[model samples]
Target: MKYFLWLLVSVALAGSISSCRSTKRIQTAISKKDTAAVVPVVDAKADSMRFIHEIYQAIERNRIDFNTFSAKLKVDFSGDEGKKRDFTAVLRIKKDSAIWVSITALLGIEAFRIMVTPDSVKVLNKLDKVIQLRSVSYLQELAKVPFTFQELQALLIGNPVFLDSNIVSYRKNEKTISLLSATDIFKHLLTVSTDDYRLLHSKLDDVDVLRARTCNIVYGDYVNKNALLFPTYRGITVSEKTKVDIVMQFKQVDFNVDLTFPFNIPRNYKRQ
Candidate 1:
């Protein structure tokens, strides 16, 4: 069950190639014709810089701003050991303040309730009748990254994470634009829609050459709520020495709504 909580946090935490070919005959003809024709020298660097600026502007334009967020979602999790679990999770977030989650098992029985703040983390395991409390640093230890409450909030809210200004390369097609950025911690490859720049996918790899940590997150099924484009479906995979996959489908979602996070530890529950 503790592992499940880790997966949940990781879920909040966590691309294609194309080739073009030219025929030999076409290449030969172009070579002969271009002998007399002066080819225009394209400034590749300037074009790339312009495109990167446009991408940055588009991302800012589509960024979602909300006071509160609430969602009821179905979570399916699979671990490296071939264990699979499906459950319902209700999540509520008061932006930049607190995040509350309740997970329900079969027959809608409450299994675990979690509340996280900027400074602390609390977990109530109903099945085991135990409560675990730890500092926010515990999440960083588990995630193997400098984790923070703001990062978690961005993940849950479907905002970009680990994005760097130093975008080294980019690829664009008719449907999507992919940007690759390198940082001290991660090499983040983020893909977005060509039309509106909504986030489509994100891939993260550890910058350390020896570390084998990677994560992939895909966003889809976008719906417009209160003029905000919200992704209702998310698929996440995290791999290190082992792999864990999680799929989340939002059954219901609302933004800027009144919310209450009721959490009370039972007297009989043991503290761990």
Candidate 2:
């Protein structure tokens, strides 16, 4: 009886080991397969303009799942061709129109903190120990955080704001969504997904300005938990060659929470 029990135990242990190895192998293969599939789908572009519009439609129809989110942003300023600014920001977004962002370099020095709500914009230069609260005017100023003030608000609340303007003679080159801006400053372009409607990438070019006016952005790392495509990652570049990458990973998201804005600046913080 003892000999028989020993044999059974050995066989059981061997089966367990074989099962574990098989599971690991399967998981690795799945990972490779998924990566391969996602790469091409993201690259496909029937027409950048239509893709962007489709993305707008998807977000418009699917904005129901937006709530709250948090992510780390990476900004890079140095590019080989002297075209971009090198900086990275890690951003945490709450659906209440609130955002907390920290910007730094690859070496992790010179950190900047920015916080924005529906009515207030607070920028803190942690390295300088200075803070500024100002009125919202995003169309004029460029940053890795908010594409535009309206978009910032939407991002803070987990909504899509890229749909603010209509498609006025959209253009694309398989990898880009170009929108002719009515304004003199912005030449808009955005990269979108095919299998689903999500803004995969975003970019803007100045019609007449030189050097410092162009921007390129890529959005990825989608987490499809709430029946919507939530961009878990975002990258932005200014000036073309040197890239400022902003990376974000969403953590907590709450939907339909009562959010209010005071827009009141603190009396203590100094104004620039």
Q: How many residue pairs collide in each prediction?
A: 0, 26
List ranges where model 2 is wrong by over 4 Å. 1-56, 64-67, 71-97, 102-113, 124-129, 138-148, 155-165, 169-184, 209-212, 240-272
Error of 1 at 181 (Å): 0.8
For model 1, the stretches where C-alpha displacement exceeds 4 angstroms are 12-44
The positional error of residue 261 in candidate 1, measured at the CA in angstroms, is 0.7
Tens-digit lDDT track for model 1 on 1-272?
A: 56655765665444221111122211132122221112222233777888887897789778889999999988777778888878888999999999999988888899999999999999999999999999998888788788888888888888887766787777777998877776777777777989889998777777664766677677778899989999887777776778777777886889998999999998999999
Q: What global local distance difference test value does model 1 have?
A: 0.75
Q: Give the TM-score (vs. native) of candidate 1.
A: 0.86
Clashing pairs in 1: none
Error of 2 at 92 (Å): 4.8
